[model samples]
Target: MVRKLVSVAITCCFVGSVVAEADIKNLLEMDLDEILKVNVATGTSNAISEAPSIVSVITQEDIKAMGATTLAEAVEQIPGLHVSNSVNRLTSLFGIRGIRNNNTPNVLVLIDGVNIAEITALSVPYAFRYPVNFIKRIELIRGPGSAVYGADAFSGVINIITQSPSDLAGTSAGVNVGSFEYSEAWINSQFSVDDLSVALSITRQRKGNDSERVTQYGVLQRDGEFDNIHVNATYHELTFNGWYWRSEQEMGSGAGIIGNDIDRDISETISAQLRWVTDIDKFTRFETDASYTNHKLDGLFQLFPEGTWPVGDDGNLFLPPLLL
Candidate 1:
């Protein structure tokens, strides 16, 4: 139940898989015990597990074993974190170490070492729905990380790692359906041309507010649909990833009013990242990273239900007739 858990999830499932370009053989054989011994900082060589903060890492196997559907649900299993829904949009919201708020502010989210948090809101839009099908692992830091990760890593950091080619293992697809009219479908494929390897995933999901207890205005209509595409490629020392996601989420309550159910919030986001790594010597490694992201959101709000506003020539609200 970490604040910005959705963003962390979206950072994982939104962008999807990762490419283990350099040192694939070594990375493929490393186990959790070896991972725990890995050093993050190249300068001071600090161990992530025993550093100035408390840290936890959750593997993909762990999530699958838990039978958790969403990334928020998976992260909530950790202690000292919580996740809940926002009032109007019903987006994911939670807190870290008792620092609770409605929106994400103090937490920093990263996917494969790339920053994907929306600049203005400091979190992904609520419209960005995340599924757990594509995640590889999650890293949580419960204390200060500002000195290493910059200003946004105040309360904690949720670093999501994605699946590699060895993990995906060619192509696979699945579908999920259950109560509340919820359904999800996804496909993952991987291929290699000579030394260039590529992995891709596409997902579509929808959920209906069928539960009488899901919203305050149970009589009003509420539902949402999401589509996402992700691509990861690698050629020796160079690696790249790109993602496209779109969502149309219904607002169960009109601007948080007690009993008003209104319209929808729609959004689209495109993100890309590139990285390079090389061994400088027997004891040194050189690495560089770059990323780019663009996103847009629109709230189609309705103050009242249908027929509340006068119809116009275009079927939208007009200036109304002049009073005599």
Candidate 2:
């Protein structure tokens, strides 16, 4: 339970074991209300254990034991939250409570209190699975949190805390492999100098299609590979966090028609945040934060295979023999 959990692919990993002991906060032992009372989930800067609600906490240990290699798989363990598939791109759908949409925008997702939900094309990020190799613990609020997080918190909130210098003893690395040619590897490093502390983690994974999904057209291709990098640094009350992840894979099916095997779906996202906590006066302390995130989804889709004539001279079109 002391090892770092590496998230790879949706089919290979299933956090569907999400809790390890929280490093400094020891979240595994804390009550749900006490956990929610912190992390800016409320307007008042005070404990609110008196509030009634349902919640769940998963630590690194829990995530590893459950064979979870992706954030989506780990989150599936939460009660009332279901992870489904989406055809729009290769992304996953998050259904909380009774509300299940293409993207499930009602549920807010955050990493270190910063929102990562997509604002344009989808609800969550562009990728189907996000690596959890750098996670410390995941704290969840399974009910309305509009008062603190705004409109996106209607269904619930998933707050992810990344590892800190104190969380890592030194350096750690591991590799994971599963069926369907799925494989993953990750490395983590932590160090301290004077008052400065830094933690860095990187992960890479790839998977091949199961080659068993057959349709009228033919078999489906779901092979893909992903790379992720995360860094966290702390200097006094100021902290800096950044992340980057890229994914490329063949269309599981296709947006419109069966994509050519040569076609692929690619997506990339990057985010950076700077946070500072200082005392406004003698009694009250104020927290300030600034962040930036960019997400892009792009791909080459060949609905019609090569050697096929889209504009045929003859009135009747000739189809590929295999397609028939």
Candidate 3:
């Protein structure tokens, strides 16, 4: 049997109103065959009539229609791709072509060509923490991209293109509320002056529960409060992106959930990236990117009392308590 691969391509022209209008008009006037022949740029630097690998496109319109609030929800619309809850439920796992892993380190994710996978954990943070409101479109490649993207593109690659100044046209803001005491608000704006163009977006979200429960030692486990902030800005050929996420939740029964407010686990992630791009010639280009990411976990598991000590093999009490 032959296995089938699928890729996604986003087809919205976000340069400016004039170009967008013209492209829309042209698309409307094109026949089915012409539309099918449209080129995509995800597989290579140059656009090709057809993607070298199986490809699919998800446009902003589709995302809006589906009312997807997160990147994982938006990606679930594509065929052969499924999103699952991580062990902690605070993160997400991506499954493609029946392949699944704990951390999903095989998939590569890019934002405007900058890689956002956490270096230490080797996981795509965008899968769980990314907001979809500021995205212009997404291009998904459903086959191996290691040849072009190097390692971590073991299974596939996802390239997320954010809204540009021309795409925004003006300032906009929105608020969202949902079950489980979830709420989110965001603002986005764009403008251009002379040769310089600027686009900015910021979002904040808060939630009470992550929506999954675990059972350990015959006790029920529940997640806790979560907060996240994301910011993206672009000026001319330079771009900056940053995200901060924090979770304050009970450490679960396995960690000896001492009390509702006593045993706690706090996880925090901070990431930032600055990128610049320029054209050296008609057929050549240069790009540079700098990034910093940190993931910290601090908490008191409290498997035993603070004063309790552990006995060593020498049958003597150790100096320090065996704090989990």
Query: Which candidate has the top score in lDDT?
Result: 2
Could you give candidate 2's per-residue lDDT for residues 1-324 as a string of tens digits?
A: 011112221111111122335575545335654344545355332343523446577878889898788888898998788888776655787777877787777888877777777665436665557888888778777888887788898888887788877778799999999999999999999989999999999999998876787755566667889998888999998888888878888766632455355676677777778877765555556566777777776766665565444536775456557644
| Candidate 1 ranges beyond 4 A from true positions | 1-30, 33-48, 214-222, 255-262, 304-324
Local distance difference test scores for all models: 0.68, 0.72, 0.63
What would you estimate as the lDDT of candidate 3?
0.63
- Candidate 3's TM-score reads 0.68
**Which one is best on TM-score?**
2
lDDT of 2: 0.72
- The better candidate by lDDT, 2 or 3, is 2
User: lDDT by residue for model 3 over 92-143, one digit each (tens)?
Assistant: 7777777778777877887766566654446654224577878877777776
Cα misplacement distance, residue 250 of candidate 3 (Å): 4.9
The residue-by-residue lDDT of candidate 1 on 73-164, one tens digit each, is 88899899887776646667657888757667677776665666765456655644667777777777776677777777778787766666
Task: TM-score winner between 1 and 2, please give it.
Answer: 2
